[model samples]
Target: MVRGAPSGDLSGKTVLVVGANVGIGLEASKHFARMQPARLIIACRSEAKGKVALAEIERETGYNGCEPWIVDLANFASVIAFADKFKREGGDLHILVMNAAIALPVYQPTIDGWETILQVNYLATSLLSLLLIPQLVAAGRKSTVPSRMVIVSSGVLYWLTPAKEIETSLKPLETLGSEEWCIPNHMQSRYSESKLLNLFFVRALTDRLRSVTPLSTIAVTPGFCYSQLRRVWYEKPTFSFVKIVLAIHERLLAWTAEQGSRQLIFAAVGGRDDEENMKGGFVSRGRLVEVADFVLSDEGHRMQDTVWNETIDILSGVSDKISPIVRDYLVVPDSSIN
Candidate 1:
């Protein structure tokens, strides 16, 4: 089991955990409630699921202050509406845990005209994280302390390599979302590739946060827990072989959801240096670790810039607030100046 998180009193802090309706997200939200936050917002896609999560946290932790809010990562409009609602009425937020993600074995498109996994796991997640920066900054300034954005990534990123099609394409995001790349062969690695993009976003965002001292972000891997991430594989008959292999792997190495949530708790409410080191760092198990070896290669650096640029350009089209958020709150890397 992972060690416990360093104790911190969150009597006046506002903690929001997106995708907290189940699994690691639900476990993490329950842990945060024990810290006695001023307001613990449980962000979920469905109102019923959110209410159930809130009730569970209250019953388990005896913290009745948790609020259920619908924040659907599959829809860009829903994400933007939540962020805007918070901006208008919500107070400063201290810890934002972005733990919502999906794993689909087929090419499923959201109503927004993008692949389901691509939008939920990358594009919409990126939009919400960037959009909420101003609120995070306000909380940090108010307390004269730092705020954290703990984005749940995965260790599987290190095992996968980007397709030649993606690596060679000038427009990586477009190429990724193209129907040509969503075939069976490519779908096998869709979730892994999305995790890779998460790291790249962290790398780029960490660089941008250099200009904003009040906020720090880190991407964390829960290290293969028994979670609902593989629900698609179970529900889809075509993935039977894949499911058998995963069940074996999971029974052999997967941690309990509570055990995995420990890493997120530590990242969200760890010691001073722990939080300070969150500047785009990667966490796995219970400690900070280096990113993938591929991520350190020259090709990796170039690809990081490409993913960052493509994502930002797309998000700028999604919401006009993105470009200004980059300009006013973040410093663009020198390589992206053009």
Candidate 2:
């Protein structure tokens, strides 16, 4: 069981939880709403589903500050539009949670031509984070309280293939939007790889923000939780046996969504006294833990640097208005890039 709740009051602050329609995101949204934020935005791809979630959260928590916003991570254009709209009209964002993620039982490519898991979980996620840095920074400057950007990473990242191996297999930077590199049989591996990328992104972004911004960027894993994340795998025809095994495991071992979301809540709002130490660190089960050795190795650092540069290059092409600081952060010694 998780050990803490958000220690701070959210009065007058604006919080946004992306992909909050179901699972851990939904539960986390409800948790945040109860803290009495000035405004709570529940962002999802489906406005209909998002509205339903918005209503449910308000009904259950009696926190009427919640509203729904549309953001389809599978579509890069949608991500761009959402960010642009938020920048233009959304008020200062004190807390931003990148909690939405997808896991596919079968490989599929998004309209953007990148694999679905990669697009929704990593690429578009990186795009939105870069686009919103200016707002987070602005909000951080004005608020007496620390502003935060939380990335919902997973501990399963440790089980993924080595960074160098996965990088060589995908050569993602070179094959940005191409389907030729994605294999149908590799869907599960791809999902794990995406989560690993989340860790890398958190580390890279935290390094960039250290000297320039007060915004706290951190990553946390909710541990193994029973959530809708695995529904697709269970529903698919090819996985009936796998579904049975998962059902049994969930019944006996997995934490309920609400139980699991505590980690998210804690990571988002707890440990305020040590927020600086939490930056770029990985939290699991409500405690900051050491990262896997592979993630700290020399090769691992190279992998993170490569992913950071490639991500910036991709998002820069999509939106020419990226913040100057974000662009400059991607600038590393030429040796680092190679």
Candidate 3:
């Protein structure tokens, strides 16, 4: 049942998809182009690669409304600049897809001083999302339909628990991203933990925004798909036998990248009649699904707030402007959850 989104017109909406040059990001961008949004911003890591994606989309869909922008998730400065640029140039944001992520075989700290996976997947992602919330709120309030924010996560999260070291730390996200706290044996789980953080963030954001405006923020898992996301397994040195096993295993079970992208499209604009089901929901292969048992657990709820507060504290420090935006737009976190 892997397919593009069902017939839907994106005529008035403005859409942005990050990490759109390859893998699911690329495929989703292509599909979005066909829907013909008012504007389609393809945010990539570099200008050259982004232009290539833009060209391909235009050629494939004959959609002239697409533009390419560069934003590096590892660089907070870059993310801030892109947000400022988008706001100055546009009125209200409609569809925002936070689609960029990384899976590294080892812990490598970025120049920004956060471990690569945590920064790209969570911290910087949160930074960008926070900066854009006001615009989302504005668009949502004016329109009868809810604006959409899709946080791409993975189902692999069901198989992970916070490493004891990360769990014991007072700051779970900070510890998970800190080189000093990295457990030698825990490197393999970093990617999975990052996805868990996404789900936590979606729940936190959705709960806080319920009364604020017409916005639906949903977390989605594209399911295991054949993607360049696992390039690290091929690029970095490992036992040849191990590489063979990983490759074959994925080849046998994975969906095509295009197949995975459909779920993203479905999340972005699907469920118009049942928008309530999508608010704070998770979807797989275009169907609404419950989060894992742990995500619905009492402890999981508490941990999500911890992650949200720490995220706000860290991101608020990045720019003084963030404080006013959060205060003016987003409602205060529900005390019941705290």
Candidate 4:
């Protein structure tokens, strides 16, 4: 199907799939497995689920080098621990797919007391990627080719709150429950806000990486695949009917999870070595497309800088936490020559 991948032969690369336990993420793990990569790490929230998912991927792809790493993307402490563990274990990484997320049923706070969906879907991802930057950079220096950062952002970002509405202050979701706080009726809009952040974060990182490193960054939507994430879009009885419709819809107009992986495949290893052809771009419907929102405007870059600086301020303790790990993991010389 979908003519396989352009070159599904990752015989010597290391791919790390966030949220590899389910949905499009699981499918991505299988895709990487088929590429016959040297190592496939399924970064998952649950150890048991990760093991089972790994087994299934190996069974399906006949590529047995795949393994799993426990990671909870919602909590900052957990992310720090995961990164430290990777460094301690000498885990070299090539590709980092920021794919795991939490969808709120009713608004709640994460363990660190931040809004759940935004915390899990955006802020935590930004932090984890930053923490792993040293390792990623190390791998890139060692690689003979360009390494990649495939940020799985959303196409729906174009439809949400305008770039102007993203407040600098952390607003409480409880404020929205009041009748006076009404701007609209849908809470789903908050999820949209988080997706919008994904775009801004990637854009900011893209610019920073363009100046500092050769490791390319590309943000892309995975099209619409059938997954647990659809629970947010439809209700139960409606969900049943919607599934029936979707089954027929797929028969008429949809791609499988494998087909949907094309954008990522291309971003990771496809395309010619042309800077204009790739890098700091967004992919959708299996093609490199301009990010279609005010987020891509000049004012958009200003907005991104503001948000990014504020984010760095908020996550100030991150790099400091890695310092201890670096001390422990680095091979200190016996003595310095005077």
Candidate 5:
């Protein structure tokens, strides 16, 4: 049985939840608020929506120190601006949850001219994490407390083709503007690629942070939650019955947002000092499951390395000091699958 985390006693800890306007993000913010964190940074695209969420959370949880900040991950300029503003005004961030993602409607280019889904899900998340690493590092150095960076990845990374094929498929999207080249219909490549990118990116960050002392980076999938994002797929009138059936299924198999946030909370502040059990991998239902067996294979690690290099190159362009921690550890891929 999963023991309740040693009380919601975050007290002086400062936690930041990206994409905190709705769904899992909102629930996570509220959960952190209940812990009475020193500060809760609600990063979202809509200031209005974020404010509404913040107010509701404060009211429901009787917790304070919640603030909303605008950030559009699809745009690079906005991500940099948000990070700079946070660096100037926002205090030390002890925990940063990379929870924002986008499943593109069709193939589109972001402001940086990269694929929209990839830009938001991978590139944008990387930039934000890189920009904020100094804060986490500084906090670790100054307070002698552990800090964490958690990326909310997906289980689909293991569901797709072999890692070897991924490398072969990784190439330039010649028709960035063409709907014909869009994903989902074409074997759901876009979504799968973005999820896979998340795994590799987090693994890379984990490796880079090992020697930084007291700081940790972990990646995990939330499992198939019954989120509004899922409802977006059942918009058609004919899918009503199917939606109902799926909704029931989701209710049975998927946990609520609060339940979904448990592992994230655990990753943030659940384990004890002596409990070195839940370090890395995909986690869910308060348990760490092995990712698909192949995910641990050489090809999988190489895939992670490939994406790690690409992510580092992208972030390096933004900040020269940004580096991925490469280390040897008992790192697991999907903690929720096994």
Candidate 6:
């Protein structure tokens, strides 16, 4: 089991967890409540599930700061509405955890044109992060404690290989999102690709925030936890035999939900003194670790830049609600791109 307790206090802070209904997310929410935050907002796709989680958190932790808010990551509009409501009613946002993600064995497109995994895990996650930046900046400026954005990524990203299609183009992001690249046969790769993008986004955003905001952005791997995310494979008919094997493996090797959540809790509250160094860094097993060698290569640097620019461009087209400061930070100058 993972070990370590959350350091410092969150007595009057406001915390938000995007996927708080199950697994590590639910466990993390309970941990946050125990820290005595002023408010703990549980944001998830289903109101019913969120209510159940809210009650469970309160009952387990005996902390009443927990509340449920519905936010669907598959729909950009839903993300916008959730952000808008929080801006209107929420207090200073101290901790923002982007932990909601979906991995599917079958190919499915979201209401947005992108594949389901891509939409929920990367695009919509980006939208919510961008929309909420102003509030994070404000909170950072006024609070003595540093505000943070913890992105839950996966160690699976280490397995990603450069796609042949990506290598053939000067602009890789255009082809990377194509349907041929995101179908079922390639679903595992697609999920790994999304986690890679999460790392890229964290690095880029951390650089942007360093000068203008006190918000520290970092990526973390929970080290192979047992979670509902495995349902994608277990629920498939063709994978029944594989499922049984995996179940046994998980029982033997995977961290419990509570154990898995300790990493995220540590990232949120334990490493305050190292916030500057932690910015844009990756954490695994409670220690800062180097990203994959490919991610540090010249080609990888170019892809990261391309992905960041493409993400901002796509999000800008979808929502005109972005504040000017956020727009300024995200928009790549025409000269720089050219």
Candidate 3, run of 10 with poorest lDDT:
329-338
Stretches of candidate 3 off by over 4 Å are 1-4, 210-212, 335-338
The lDDT, on a scale of 0 to 1, for candidate 3 is 0.86
Worst 10 residues of 6 by lDDT: 329-338
Model 4 local distance difference test score: 0.69
Query: How would you encode candidate 1's per-residue C-alpha lDDT over 1-338 as one tens digit per residue?
Result: 56765567899999999999999999999899888999999899999999889888998999988999998888999999999998986789899999899998789889898999999998999999999999998898888678988888899988988877787677898988878779988888888988898888887888777654688788899888999988777776574777899899899988888889988988787646656566778888678899888888778888888889899899999999999998888775666421
Looking at model 4, report the run of 10 residues with the lowest lDDT sum. 329-338
Local lDDT at 5 for model 3: 66
| TM-score to native of every candidate shown | 0.95, 0.92, 0.95, 0.82, 0.84, 0.93
lDDT of all the models against the reference? 0.86, 0.81, 0.86, 0.69, 0.69, 0.81
Clashes of each: 0, 0, 0, 0, 9, 0
**Can you give the lDDT of residue 54 in candidate 6?**
90
lDDT of 2 at 284: 89
Winner by lDDT between candidate 3 and candidate 2: 3
The alpha-carbon lDDT assigned to residue 78 of candidate 2 equals 94
Return whichever of 1 and 4 wins on lDDT.
1
Task: Please provide, for model 2 over 1-338, each residue's C-alpha lDDT reduced to its tens digit, 9 standing for 90 to 100.
Answer: 56655555799888989989999999999999889999898899897998899889989999998989999999989998998889887878889999999987666878877778888989888888878877787888898756788888888877665534456533555453345556565554777778788889988887766464668888889988899998887777674777888899999999988878888888888777787788888888887888877788777777787787787777778788665657544343334421
Ranking by lDDT: 1, 3, 6, 2, 5, 4
Q: Please give, for residues 1-338, the per-residue lDDT of candidate 3 as tens digits.
A: 66556558888888999889999999999888998999999999999999899898989899999989999999999999999998898679899999999988777998889999999998888889878887887888888898999999999877877766665556887778777767566777888989999999988988777475788999999999889888888986656775898789887888988899999999998888999879888989788988887778777787888788888899888877788877776776666742
In model 2, which regions exceed 4 Å deviation? 163-165, 168-170, 173-178, 210-212, 237-239, 323-325, 328-338
Tens-place lDDT per residue, model 4, 141-213, is 7876556777788777766644233443333223333234333344447666667777777766655553446
User: Looking at candidate 4, what is the lDDT of residue 299?
Assistant: 57
Clashing residue pairs in candidate 4 (N, C-alpha, C atoms within 3 angstroms) = none
Candidates 1 and 2: which is better by TM-score?
Answer: 1
The TM-score measured for candidate 5 stands at 0.84
Question: Candidates 4 and 5: which is better by TM-score?
Answer: 5
* Candidate 3 local Cα displacement, residue 76, angstroms: 0.3
Candidate 5 backbone collisions, by pair = 207-325, 207-326, 208-324, 208-325, 282-334, 282-335, 282-336, 289-335, 290-338
lDDT per residue, candidate 6, 228-328, as tens digits?
98787876767477688879989899988888888888778767778777878888777788998778877777777778778777887888865465555
